[model samples]
Target: MPRASRLAAQLQDEYQAEVSLEKGRGGVFDVWLNDQLVFSKHSVSRFPEDGEIQSAVNAHLAAN
Candidate 1:
C-alpha cells in the first residue's frame, strides 16, 4: 500500500520511530505502535486520513 510506505516515512521523520512494514494475509492494513495495534483497516475498511496516523502514534508516544 502506498499510504503504508508514506506513513512509515512520515513517522520516521516526525517521531524518529523506526517502522517496519510486513506482509499480512490479503491486503490487510494494520498500524502498530510498540507492538500494539493502533489502526486495523481490515476491520475498519478504510485508510487513515492525512496526519491521522501520525497523530495517533504521537498521542500514544506522548502518553507513555
Candidate 2:
C-alpha cells in the first residue's frame, strides 16, 4: 500500500484536504471524495493511471 499512501499524501498536499485509504484484497479498489464515489476499479474494470485520481479530486473540489 506504499504507492497508495504516497498518492494520498500528494493528493492531500495538492488539495489541502483529508485523505483516507481502505485496503482490501481480491481487487476492491475505489476512490471517494466528499462522500462521493469518484472512481471504482471494479466498476471500470481497470486501475486508474498516474494523475487520474488527482484529476477526479480536482474536479470534485472545483464542483464544491
lDDT at position 64, candidate 2: 92
Q: What does candidate 2's lDDT look like per residue over 1-64, in tens digits?
A: 8777888899889878788888879987888887799988898899888999988877888999
Q: Could you give candidate 1's per-residue lDDT for residues 2-58 as a string of tens digits?
A: 778888898889878878998777878889988788888887788788887878787
lDDT of each: 0.83, 0.85
Pairs with backbone N, CA or C atoms under 3 Å apart (clashes), candidate 2: none
**After TM-score superposition, what is the CA distance of residue 41 in candidate 2 from its true location, in Å?**
0.9
RMSD of each: 1.3, 1.4
Instruction: Give the clashing residue pairs of candidate 1, or none.
Output: none
Model 1 TM: 0.84
